[model samples]
Target: MLGAMSSIKVQCVIKEKNEIGESPVWEEKDSSLVYVDITGQKVSRWSSLTGQLDSIATENLVGSVVPRKGGGYVIAEGTRFSFVDWVKRSFSTVAHLDKEKPNTRFNDGKVDPAGRFFAGTMGLELRPAVVERKQGSLYSLHPDHSVVHHFDQVDISNGLDWSLDHRVFYYIDSLAYKVEAFDYNIQTGGLSNRRVVYKVEEDDGIPDGMCIDAEGKLWVACYNGGRVLRIDPQTGTQLQKVKLPVQKTTSCCFGGKDYSDLYVTSAYKGMDENALPKEPEAGCIFKVTGLGVKGIPPYSYTG
Candidate 1:
């Protein structure tokens, strides 16, 4: 659908194993690569300076993690949200997302330009549910322990990123194969002017986690497609792509010194042991080069 299966020049920066590894965010200041093992409920950290990795222990069914206001991190576990001081080993539950519908769990999420956390939920039915059109929604977590549901009934809430200017918000609905956009109100935490910025054709792949570069372009991971696609946000045009040897790419983020080293993670969760040989590379961390755009620095929680 998009192109013939191809390979890009990149290596396994980190070889440690993982399950459903996703949500990678490059911490520019620390020169550390941060990501989450969704199913593991653990947050991982890899230092490029030392090439070592350490994990924070947690049991929140974590979907995403970001640097917190003063120190530590804000984690989204299932539908429960909490703040953790990994350094001190203390954690506090900030809010419960699905008090009414306990079956829903938080998926991909990230911090907005204002340092507020935004996360989304998927339909309870593995299949698209009634919430798909309106109920399954994206939420905003502010510094005050407040919450806001921005959109609803999403089939698969996979990835999200913001434009360099903080004026545009981009998000992916995995099952829909669409990366949608909205005019963002940074101060108000409001999203308007909904638009279809990019739609993946069947051949490309299912959209997973995403990151925005300094140029406002979107780098989207193609889950089953085993690759990533670079798209121009303004025109909804596909400009370039990087193919992975694996079959399921979960997420990606720009890391390394200059933000040129793109780190990616894959998943082997759904595959049966019989199908394991078909995707031996499935759950390994990967890297790529010459990925032109530099990603925006992750926002630190101030609230």
Candidate 2:
């Protein structure tokens, strides 16, 4: 049995709601948190210091957002990667992938320690009554605006992070219910020697988004599980688990001035009418405090 860890205090920080909230990224430059509402087609920014909230409408389903070193955002919207001037609310295309596969769209993504942007796609099934086929892939956007296809046959690709040493890369394919590790080349953004570092049983819920802390531990969000887990990647042991008030927990990242706060985003996308009442805060952004841990600042996309 998975042991129950101590409970931590969690609260709904943003009550505006999102259909499929994901990809929470902490911006050290503004001391704010930026995230995406995939189903709603918007990117939101929340200030921790002033409680100010802002959002930008996008043309398509936005999967993720990463800070640019040149003062903008690199976003994966639909099948295309683009640069967004948050100040001007303008977007310019960087690259488009899988144009033929309109059924596939980009999902979770993050920037590597070396400043390359990596994102993965998944089969998009709009009809809740029908099941989507697994026909997705992972790609890396280079500094020169080139893209490299890394892996194919991915299903609901989500959650990515690198180790503190920059030698190990971690990823999640939600349908597989496992976290995979790779031998990483920090200089070239290459991955190899894939292995499973952690696995989630059916009862534990599927892993969604994830972030690594300064101490080299992983904090993973549990979609449909109403919780976030802190795991020791080396031992594949559950170090801690935080229970939330709602299911459909999508993604999480360490934010706040000291990077001690764990900000989580949840979804209301697939919930039925019966499930909606029970989870009133389903689509809200949650904050988990008192973890006493710190995280490294997310690297910006230098390109």
Top model number, TM-score? 2
Clashing pairs in 2: none
lDDT of each: 0.79, 0.89
Per-residue lDDT of 156-268 in model 2, one digit per residue for the tens? Answer: 88999999999999999888989999999998999999999999876768899999999999999998888899898999998888889998898999988789889999999
lDDT of 1 by residue, 1-303 (tens): 232223347677767767778778777767888878877768888887898998986775677888886877888877877888777776788988754256667778898878889988775544321234433578889888899888776777878988877888898988788889999999898999998988899798788888877777888889888888889988999988888888788888877766767888887777778878876677878988665556656787676
* Among all candidates shown, the one with the greatest lDDT: 2
lDDT, candidate 2, residue 283?
96
* lDDT, residue 76, model 2: 93
Q: What is the lDDT of residue 273 in candidate 2?
A: 99
